[model samples]
Target chain A: MNVLNPHLKFQSQSVAKPYFVFALMLFVGQIIFGLIMGLQYVVGDFLFPLIPFNVARMVHTNLLIVWLLFGFMGAAYYLIPEEADRELHSPKLALILFWVFAAAGVLTILGYLLVPYAGLAAMTGNELLPTMGREFLEQPTITKVGIVVVALGFLYNIGMTMLKGRKTAISMVMMTGLIGLAVFFLFSFYNPENLARDKYYWWWVVHLWVEGVWELIMGSMLAFVLIKITGVDREVIEKWLYVIIAMALITGIIGTGHHFFWIGAPGVWLWLGSIFSALEPLPFFAMVLFAFNMVNRRRRQHPNRAAALWAMGTTVTAFLGAGVWGFLHTLAPVNYYTHGSQLTAAHGHLAFYGAYAMIVMTMISYAMPRLRALGEAPDARAQTIEVWGFWLMTISMLLITLFLTAAGVVQVWLQRIPEDGAALSFMLTMDQLRVFFWLRLFAGVGFAIGLVCYLVSFMQRGRVPAAVEAPAAVA
Target chain B: MSETFTKGMARNIYFGGGVFFFLVFLALTYHTETTFAARTNEAEMTEAVTRGKLVWEQNNCIGCHTLLGEGAYFAPELGNVFHRRGGEEAFKPFLHAWMKAQPLGVPGRRSMPQFNLSEQEVDDLAAFLSWTAKIDTNDWPPNKEG
Candidate 1:
């Protein structure tokens, strides 16, 4: 806590409030586009020229990335100050960067919607550098440059704060993760003429970010929240954080080979990818244990039960989604059939939701109350609604993954597994899987409703009477 | 045992192990890059194929279709499409017609937008696809329908 500014622990943390608000707004936008894509999967021509499947998917995935970035930045803004034991280096710069990032994100998404992709590419002068049209990295080259500038400014702000103040393990891990994120993103600009080489390094951005550094980010955030909510010692939690992220990077760095198995890379990847990526799940499994063990060993009750639930949920689902489901087809042999299939989509949905989405939500749930000056947590009713939102969203996402997995199984059987003479065309196989698509759409609607509950929880008032509420029981 | 497990040792493992594995990753990337000329059939990647790739990116074809089993799975895989539609001779003509067909207008079935490309552009795209088909992909897709 800053001595001069005693209204809150640190007045600088107030900036995180707007970042959370903007992130939630973008999250809603992402979900809306996701629902549109879900409908298009079944109806095909539902929004054909108006909101093409490609455009909808681009918006969905890009918005997801942007919002999570916002969440990460917000988490950094809030946690960095406390860990450093000082006021932020520059709160104004943080706000300036927020508006810049939000503007860039909105304008780029509008470009995807309003102009034809080719026209947009030309308008943005992509021919000058030509880093457009790749999946996930679909932003125009200029926007990519804007992102790099924003990231540099952000890293400088956080780094300065840490330099002038204390350097805890949690803060150090987070700073490293943030730096790695910016470095890996440079690979998005490297579009070699050789498609094989292009894909080979593209995963340097995607795989290394998600499976590698992002785990560092996730682990630190989880550790911070556990320390706060569980009344656990920082040393104990910090050691576990180091161990979990150590496993994450050790396996995840080599795990990049998993994607190289069929991308015209060397055949050595077949053995290396399988062996290394098979170990990728170990860190996620360790995370589940670390989370539960800390909670079970909790010394005091935290009022923010919803935030704690989210922390626990993130680990379990990440293991199931990133660890288990990813392992299902990660082997070179199984991936030979399942690569690019709906199974990939299945794993992608749950992994992103379970690992990234839930972790961000955990931070928001934990921080929003304190940011608003609402004591330790929100009102009891609000917390209850948030808990419901957790179950609804988590269960719906699980259902969505299962439905897609079923679709992938059928797709592989009818299309990939059959003898060449008996194999069905891609469209024919898709036609056979309409039922699963419909089920996924229904599950998506459930997720949207869950999001609604979550948003509505923010509006509820009236705290639990302190005397009437008992402290949470220790395991 | 718990007391002996210090953050110092854990931090060392995180940093030291991270650097070690990242070095291994770099070595593997070096090896992969070295093998690209032979595995990707670099000799066959003509000037027209280069232009065709530009056309493909400019159109955002990857937004919907998969190449080398990557990208959106909405449309059929195009990495092997040159071989699937009728390779070498007939693929060029088939692609030209396919580009001109515009949206299919089949109501419920998936639609491919018309790019209204010139005959030469379509031919270039065909050349690119044909070249892509030659890349050594460890015998992927299991069948020709990709």
Candidate 2:
């Protein structure tokens, strides 16, 4: 019998069902808002006195963060118990925290939309301990507090479950990642009055979350999925997880220095940021190697081809998007030209999509078939549709990155690199890049189409669930 | 494969290395906090500048604009806007006038919404930005036209 087979039928894993539901639903919202923002990029006053660009952009980014959190939480709820070989410590608490987090998230988005930001700030009592304005850290202090409370409760539930049962490497790494996520979030509360000082600490929350702790979470998740899909030896995959995460930390911790280079932090960051961030790609490279190697060395083949594809795609695209694209502008001299340009935007869009978005989809694709149909994988029809969705979204995002990168190169040439006459004004440069923005908007639509197909796959189940395929000899 | 790495060793590194690097981050943050006073010349943070900072925050200016290359890149970098538009004397008037201009309504061009800021709010915002321009950001933007 499969190791994962025993827990598949457990009621405790049912907690993950709702979590995945919310994650996918919010993912739809995120993509919709992303498209709106993409349109606003070209149309300028598309919403005018209504949604506006900033509000739409905020919703887009914040929704990405929230939905990914939901995905992570859901993944933990499902995998932790399975890996621990125990029932959840408290399913009721998991359900309650999910509701609380969802409600808080909904209210926060409404606050961003309904009220003017200034009024929202005033209403939220931002003055008492003002932490309202910063980018990505824009949630009111109360909302931030709610997040902390929810996170602690989540950690408690998962921690207790782990303690009661087995302590596997995957579970351990995941717990460490989750704990670090909660811990690093505390830095969001440290908003100093001085701008320079404010920026200095703000990155502790943003940079550390993505590059530092989240990598561990992502690595463990990938490892778990790889083991299940490829039937690779857990020991081999676990060691790879350790090595990958170690490199991720080794590079990623000091990689926070890159954000410090232009923020008036310190001069040494110029060198530190350049050298270390350049190496930030190492773990991602290793991931590509690890994933392909594991799949190639598989003792048996699992029928979840879509999941396996996603897993393989995650490693490769992450290596390219987060690793190579990031390295392109990481050095100080190169960053000086492309620091805040669309070059960064290009890297960010692809990196976040390739790393977080794709992996979550991988987990969802692998687990959803079982949860929904009580089958090992989605019916072949649904699997085909899901694969189509994958290629559409992945290819479109690549095009989007390429267009933005082209725009950024032109932007750097015309604006930053001074010419015979004075450099082009900001508006003039934006005007010049109109074509790229239009191309990006087109790609954005393609991404939306892909998202719809993905959603539709859930509806494409067969009349009867297929029998779970036994592991097939590969060699 | 040789049993070169153990689960126990991995766990140790996750915890131990995490703490060690966290300490390093704290040390860097401490250094940044202590040294920023000189870099930003915080002595210039007058009451108006403080109010201006509040005004900037309240309006979510960072949503569109980058200050010190830290916020959104939709708008130009405002960290050096004061110096770019010819110093505080010109910057204050320009910023105030700019705020009132709203939705520039120019076809196919990006527009700034009319925040309808009060005169004092405009002054405060301008003051805040003026102070922001003085920060030693290692001569960023590579030019004055930001």
Best by TM-score: 1
Estimated TM-score for each candidate: 0.97, 0.95
lDDT of 2 at A76: 94
Q: After superposition, how far is residue B124 of candidate 1 from its true place, in Å?
A: 2.0
lDDT of model 1 at position A58? 90
Candidate 1 residue lDDT tens string, B42-74: 998998988888888888898889999999989
Stretches > 4 Å off in candidate 2 = A1-9, A419-421, A462-475, B5-16
Recovered fraction of real interface contacts per model: 0.79, 0.55
Instruction: Report the Cα lDDT for residue A334, model 1.
Output: 97
10 residues in a row with least lDDT, candidate 1 chain A: A459-468
Q: What are the lDDT figures for the candidates, one per model?
A: 0.92, 0.86
Q: Could you give candidate 1's per-residue lDDT for residues A1-475 as a string of tens digits?
A: 2333333578998788889889999999999999998998999988888888888889999999999999999999999999999989999999999999999999999999999998998899998898898989999999999999999999999999999999999999999999999999999999988889888988989999999999999999999999999998898999999999999999899889999988899999999999999999999999999999999999999989999999999999999999999999999999999999999999999999999999999999998887766678898888999999999999999999999999999999999998777999999999999999999999999999999999888655223335225554321
Q: lDDT tens digits, residues B29-136, model 2?
A: 677777788998889889898888878888888888888877777778888888777684688788877778887887756667778789999988888888888888
